[model samples]
Target: MPAHLSYDVVIVGGGHNGLVAAAYLARAGRSVLVLERLGNTGGAAVSARPFEGVDARLSRYSYLVSLLPRKIVRELGLRFAVRKRTVSSYTPLGDGGLLVGEGRTRASLAVLTGGEREYAAWRDFYGMTRRAAERIFPILTEPLLTRDELRAHLDDATAWRTLFEEPIGVAVEERFRHDLVRGVVLTDALIGTFADAHDPSLVQNRCFLYHVIGGGTGDWDVPVGGMGALTDALADTARSAGAEIVTGHEATRVDTDGATAEVAFRTPGGPAVDPTDGTVTARHVLVNASPQALADLLGEERPPAAEGAQLKVNMLLRRLPRLRDASVDPREAFAGTFHVAEGYEQLATAYQEAAAGRLPTAPPSEIYCHSLTDPSILGPDLAGSGHHTLTLFGLHTPARLFAEDNDAVRARLLAATLDQLDQRLAEPIADCLALDAHGRPCVEARTPLDLERDLRLPGGHIFHRDLAFPYATEETGRWGVETAHANVLLCGAGAVRGGGVSGVPGHNAAMAVLGR
Candidate 1:
């Protein structure tokens, strides 16, 4: 083994969470080193111009931000900014569509459901969620709360039943009458989660709770200058706090004694034959990789089976596609999330089909045009040239579907998804696509398999694994990031209350190390 380079703490994986932990720990005067396998640090939260010679920079994998706590940003003094969307979402239905935003909700709800009843119900439903958010969001950064303790903290039995005891589908069905409205509400429960809305397991409820309780506001804003800006700010914060960040160095193994952990890693351009090119010893090790990845590093068995359930597609458009409903402008419809064929029945059908090992006839997906909100993503020449960037999130497309014949399945799925988008547009979306320098349309699609290969996400599960309810289960009063090894802690999305761009897990891991 090479001579050990030591530190007070070593963080595996320099993703946003790892960077957050590094910043907090280093700020407290702990010598910290962060090792990232990728050449860059952002992991899934990154921006890139995939199309050769294109001026448009797209947020490739993880698109929006909602779960990030304001406390982390404020404490870390991160300089990143997230801009709110004036329009929340627009879902096309037949010749008309529902546009929910500032000053548009009432009329859109009336049009979709033919009355003001659904709007009133929508407000009521969100009011309940808001209350739940108030109780839950505050507890995320603290030590884990037992279910009984959490229920007591929640206080209201009705809110507990709605969010914890029952499936989220029940709440949606009981509140909304319109299929489109129900689907819009249900989409929150299904993002990155592969489960039926009505699954008896209440997994959808867990998913829905996290989605709506982000920053206790439930507003998913776009990070200014793409997602990379957020990570850049995190990296800068850590570096400013004296954290050593080493990119292109992948941690290969973690060996720990009762008091210290030693990490073995390989640098870029090193010989592939040898697993360990260097070694680092630390008083504490924070793993920002997935649980399964960490288990592999420890030469232990893998964790429970988890698979990602979304297809991500990115495209640069020459011009925005005209909406079938001419009443609303294309820019308005595209500025916020554009839901395509994601009605309640549509999502259910797609889920059923995908669960049965077949692709949905009409894929359930949503899109948003980043340029409409932040034109800075495009170069000066393309800023005013009618060019825009579109990001799509397709639902119910699990990793298993692409396990065999990935390319063919991805092609068919993409075609179906685009066709579904066409149904709501005045012109074919493909016709509006911009050409890359290679004379090909500027479009890219990523399946679960693709994400696994590129992002090192085991099974491409975005949240690392299915999100657990944010309370403690086995370890009472302990930080959720605690692991079996005394000197090792989980600081990634796999940790409890750990998904999304939220730095709660990272912060808690640092707290554990600091014994605070």
Candidate 2:
């Protein structure tokens, strides 16, 4: 097929991680080919003009780039731009009032508790655990490991303690002044995990902090134009480095002999014909999509099943929803990201519901207004800018979205969000202009079975296999890239250290390939 074009490496997904790997490999003088499903290359990190003259990043879909290493930015000279913004949270009260919290603020700890004693308790809890992240951040950017290689980084006692002992949540709670702060700090624990926030193996907090500290807490960065530009820069870098990135090519199957693997996919412009059985032989294959997608590609070649799933929803709002503090300007409020957990108890309950496959009544949601962070998104005048988008993550949706009667669930999620906004903003619903659901229209809806059919991940487990359990411990933390497969590497979100914008999968996989 196509004259048997061969390369040293063939990357699937064209997502940020795949792009990162392709760029690095190409720079090292290896020939590479990057395949993407969407017309655009960026996987989740994409931008589109939803309305005329008003551009909003699908920012809410997968916002922020904290886990992305600053060193990689400099080394690649990847023209991606990021504005350092703080992280803030507001819980709207029914009384047209708001409660605010910050990463390192005493005021934030106060918001989490009802009194001084709890605040002191929370402060201590947060301080001790903050060290957990500090200790692990520098280590994630390195290569994956073998058991012996992993042990080289850990002293015997630390290794033993991490494996057989230590509870992640309780360990974190011991450092914070308020339960809410502990929940937020521990929130990272559930990003791709199925465990309860307060579950045992407290060292998981260290894993959470590892990702947080990699980007530095409170330093949320915004792409200059939209998230799409970041992906664009990556694509440009890959192209400049001599990698061929072909979009609109949907991979159907990965045929493998005992030694080499070949990807089969379809190019666009046909009358819905089955995928062409083309093949690319490579010394190494890097999958940048979710683990669930990869599992499907392998068919019976599944990794041990990992529980839990990632559900994302995007909404186009008539206007920004009002929150607890009406006095806080929307611009200042939008400077950082926001979440919808009133306190620790509420957050814990939400996480539990997600694990149970029930949509939490008061689902924990992330609200990001990219237009506020990057002026380019808004028109010449920002106010009354009817065009805006809000991405809700950590949202608990039913296991099935396409099933009949799912509208009831959607309505409930919408109503709860609207009620919260009305109470928080002191604003009326009449002011809202347009509405769209990303799940129904953008992601799960448009790309039905995409996570399963293409990426081969389980239940669209977007964060990769569960790493917080076995991967987070001291003994295994150093095993960032080594998987059980030979010549087969772990180069997705679930790779050691797990998830976020860090590009560690691709970076670490590259090191493994280069034997660096």
All candidates' TM-scores? Answer: 0.97, 0.80
Q: How many residue pairs clash (N, CA or C atoms closer than 3 angstroms) in each of the candidate models, in the order given?
A: 0, 38
- True lDDT of residue 207, candidate 1: 89
Best by lDDT: 1
Residue pairs in clash, model 1: none
Give me the displacement of residue 58 in model 1, in angstroms.
1.1
Q: What's model 2's TM-score?
A: 0.80
Instruction: Please list the residue runs of candidate 1 whose C-alpha ends up more than 4 Å from where it truly belongs after superposition.
Output: 1-4, 270-276, 475-477
Clashes of 2: 38
